[model samples]
Target: IKDFLIKNKITFIEDETNNNEKFTRNRIRKNIIPVLNASIAGGLGKFKRFFENTDSVLMLFDFLIEDRLNIMKSKNPIILDISKILYYNNKLRKNLLYYILSKNLFVDSSLIESIDRVISSKRPNIIFKEKGMIIEKSYNDLKIEREAGDEFDKEDFLKPGMETLFNGYTLKITKTVFIESLLKKKNVFVFPLSAGRRFKIRTLQTSDSFVPFGMNKEKKVSRFLMDNKISLSERRRVPLILNEKDEILAVGSLRRTGLYRMKKQKGCLCIYVGKN
Candidate 1:
């Protein structure tokens, strides 16, 4: 087949169906017997003609299925939440479930049953479908937030010239000591120390309340960005500071409440500011 395609300058995709016993069992259980019955009733002949007329459509479906399967394998194993079954019609839901089973994707049958029960009782939830996956909405008020930053590389939270005060003694910048200091603060400033690299800063003038990590968050910057789908380049910038207590004093828009005061007390204030 490969040689024929190459010699004729023809492009064709080959689907190799496994002939192993395990796959045979699956075919028998899911498709073969049903198809045989339909064939006796002339349904299979109609289906064959339909597929012949829709060759391009079938090709597209095959490509989509292959792409989705590749993605599923590359990522973690398929996982589904049962909460979404209510959103799809019965036929679609069953087809989706059958696809997962045919692909050998792991799913909690109990969860699917539970979801059906909930829907039967007049409750419906969000639905998500991807690859051999299906999930139901589990939480009603869940909020999702996103941030743009360099992938965490070597924890560059503390850089040169940042000061830290420990037990009344001011300590100079050292990698070990810097990391130790950050462990104490609930919120710490993080910035890449390499020169010319830009660190994102949020300012009062341009920032909005959207808390990415707190219980009930507030941040206007995030809200504005989301409302307009703002790109990262247009976001506001802020200052990055390291404190005498080995903490991130201020992220950019807001000062760590006592960071400036501690810097003055130590008389060894060294600031390393990055541009982005």
Candidate 2:
């Protein structure tokens, strides 16, 4: 019959009401139904037990569907609330928020707007709420600024006693006897030049090591530059050499580590800068 219906494309709906009578009679009148009726003679007890079990199963199914629907609708399953003042007044808060959002948190548009409003408010003592967190800015916590006044001139030591090799360039006589000897030679040379925009060399020496700011440990001149923040422009203009042990001996605009240490110890072969 099922095959025949399918072949004919017959659409039919089963009438559960017809089966309901048979099902109830089997449990109540006959008292021969399974588990719910096996030990109970009265129909009420068996029916009640059957209804309870059925309800429990249906309840579980409903709960699962509801949970799935909720998950689908929620932007952030684990909602977070931050105080408006805290969010706007502290850079750390902004960084933390960016980190959390980057981690795929379900952040809402309101939360973002609230953060912006707090940040842009004219008064420092602004307060607002976002998500479940309350943010309040404390006026007292505002960063204090120092007044800029008399500016002391930085003594330029690379001026006197140095011969001009290139335009705006000079080679000062270093206290290092070996460097002085090298400088005196036609091939060996020194050019007082700036390092990259962010750095300046206070000393130069025959042997030095630099950790390259972000790298693990001090590396050779070439390795440090390759690993660190050296720009192509600076690298092209800068001069660096390695010692026999493959250690970085000198880097333009950055004091050689060995030379800096030696200068601190008041050792030989140290150079000090004086005003031009």
lDDT of every predicted structure (CA atoms): 0.36, 0.37
Best by TM-score: 2
The stretch of ten residues in a row with the least summed lDDT in candidate 2 is 152-161
* Highest lDDT against the true fold, candidate: 2
Give the count of colliding residue pairs in each prediction.
18, 11
Which whole-number lDDT from 0 to 100 does residue 262 have in model 1? 27
> Tens digits of per-residue lDDT for model 2 on 1-276?
768888999997766664453344432333223323343356446566545765444443334323421212222232333332242234444544443342232244566556545555577676554443454544523211112223321112222122211112222333222333433443332322222111122222324455443345676565566565877544444433332333333454343443222212221232222222
Report the C-alpha displacement of residue 25, candidate 2, in angstroms: 99
Error of 1 at 83 (Å): 9.2
Model 2 backbone overlap count: 11
